[model samples]
Target: MGVHTLAELTTFQVGGPIAALYEPQTHDHLVETLRELWSEGEEPLIIGGGSNLVAGDEGYDGPVVRIAHPGLEVVPAEPGRIVLRVSAGVVWDDLVAHTVSSGWSGLEALSGIPGSVGAAPIQNIGAYGQEVSAVLSAVELLDRYGEDPVWVSADELELGYRTSVLKRHRGEPAERDAVVLTVEFVLTDAAGLSAPIAYGQLAGALGVELGTQLPVADVRASVLALRASKGMVRDLSDRDTFSAGSFFTNPIVPLAAARSLPEDAPRWPVTPVAVEPTVIPLDHYTGELPGYAPTAAPELVKLSAAWLIEHAGISKGFRLPGSRAAISSKHTLALTNTGGATGDEVAALARFVQARVSAEFGVQLVPEPVLVGVEI
Candidate 1:
């Protein structure tokens, strides 16, 4: 029962000491730990890199299970389809770099986001106009209520924009509990060409048509470079990188409201059912637009939370008087611990930004990271 502080495990460099932490190196050991804990009436919280989590300063009182399982196998199930079975505990960007280096195309656009591969499909991670859901075929999970692992097709997970059934709760009419052990992605033999470059910047960088394909390695390089500029890529020495990636899911608003905003309100067609709103309104004379925009419609519009934060007068490194927690100096969306901060201080900073954004824009900024022992 080794113990460590959340500060030691998470990117945020905050949080108190956990009661007990267990790292299972193999699947059998992981299952055994779970079974033994269950027999003792303990339900441990599963953790990976702790990138997308905000542990309370008080820390978790229960057992913490860290999945250390590792393996990546490329199995050819058919002539053109290759199922890449990746352990859930694998660091995500490392896997992306690996796949691209091997001439694989599907995972390129998701290049630089932090956290483990196992946590990717939980929210169907997306960036630069590409999402993991498009390539995910199935997931192998250890049912919290059952014994053996079962394979659930992508459809069963009900993946959505930044959401999935695993994230949604079950039982309590909204409670859902299932631990993902491994994930399989179905990749195509594209002969070094990347997936159709749906994102505009990416397409521009590759100097190809929107639906055209470029070399997979080129696409990966471009995506990584772009992410690094925004502080989205994790850098241990850069305090700005001490975050859970984006702090908020881009808000998807109704098309009518989007259209009513201004002729230049940034918008893009999302699904056939919805529109995505970009934070930089086309008519936004404020000159405060962020780099990305949404391109969906009818179902919802994507709006940048970072844009809203700045628009609400919260600038980079904004902090309450005498508070150690502050907004990232390099990125407006991330709330960082400059030094000597606590969970409560971080939560306070998040609340201040949330309230300011909501009051100014009439749209609430929902947090992107999962909160443990604290409410945002």
Candidate 2:
């Protein structure tokens, strides 16, 4: 209904007050405001849970449209499939918990991810080998360039690992013009059976072979517990949960580049051409050349950013001199505000980590959260 500061909305608790904040109670009001803003040449930022953003100390100069539009309707579109049209403003984790409690099988593994449903497709949120894109049927969007609300198929989103067309931009302003209003997902009506377990840890916890099915509720519980242990779950009391989940997307490097590492480096396949390695650093040690040399080939490899941070000698609770901001003591990836920290302080810690990781490993780490008025 009205405006609020970034410090009032975001989990980080460090941004300056926003210029304007709007929470439209209905879709029609949202469309009208958006259309007016677009016609007037205003580019408003669409905010959801404010969990995945890093607002600057100066805050946003533009209008901040909080997507509070609400609706959740389920219709049986076909046998064994239920079409769920979820409003983008719905709290994402709440929806997952609801669906699992109702015996639905699709979103159990995504149980504890913070943020709103509307923001899910913006990055195709994924974890534990299951991605929101896998069950996504279509998205309802308010087109910035056009006058009407349009329904875009999943194919239109160009969904991939932690990315979508909305995020890529592709040299056009189309992404900025589009605001997701609602999302549709196709879920199964299986009697308590969950989607096939794909992540190794989940499989081991369930005591089943990879790709085996278990009870949907069990999968949701296991996923939540796993995330909490990593400080991924949002908890205001715990400074570790102040982060925007994992700070970096796993680096996808070429297979040849992966092979150049010592025999002890851990790796997993992203594709036939790419392999992702655990975050451990290979260049921490200064030494003479081995039998293998670093390759220049364009093979793709995915490396963990957290592992690189630990290897760079930045252990948990790492602080810069006398700063109040420090890395989360529970998880290496999270940079937390231990009270009295400013946006600049948080950004400083992030840059320090990135610089150290890159210097020690020869690999650059890209931040996962969207930055407001600061650079890392």
**What is the clash count for each candidate, in the order shown?**
34, 12
* Residue 111 displacement in candidate 1 (angstroms): 0.9
**Which regions of candidate 2 deviate over 4 angstroms?**
1-3, 168-176, 272-299
The C-alpha TM-scores of every prediction are 0.88, 0.89
Tell me the TM-score of model 2. 0.89
The residue-by-residue lDDT of candidate 2 on 1-376, one tens digit each, is 4657787777777788777887887878988988987888888887889887777788888888888778899976877887999999999999999899888888999999998999999889999989989999999888778779999999999887887877633123335358999899999989878999999988987788999998999999899888998888988777788777776677677777667654655566665433344243567645544444554435466666677788889999889988878888888888877887788888899899988977876767777777777678
Give the alpha carbon lDDT tens digit for every residue of 157-253 in model 1.
8888888888732112113477888899998767888888898888887778899888889999999888887787888777778777777777778
Where model 1 places Cα greater than 4 Å from the true spot, the runs are 168-175, 260-263, 272-299
Deviation in angstroms for 306 in model 2?
1.8
TM-score of 1: 0.88
What 10-residue stretch in candidate 1 is worst by lDDT?
168-177
Scored by Cα lDDT, where does model 2 land? 0.81
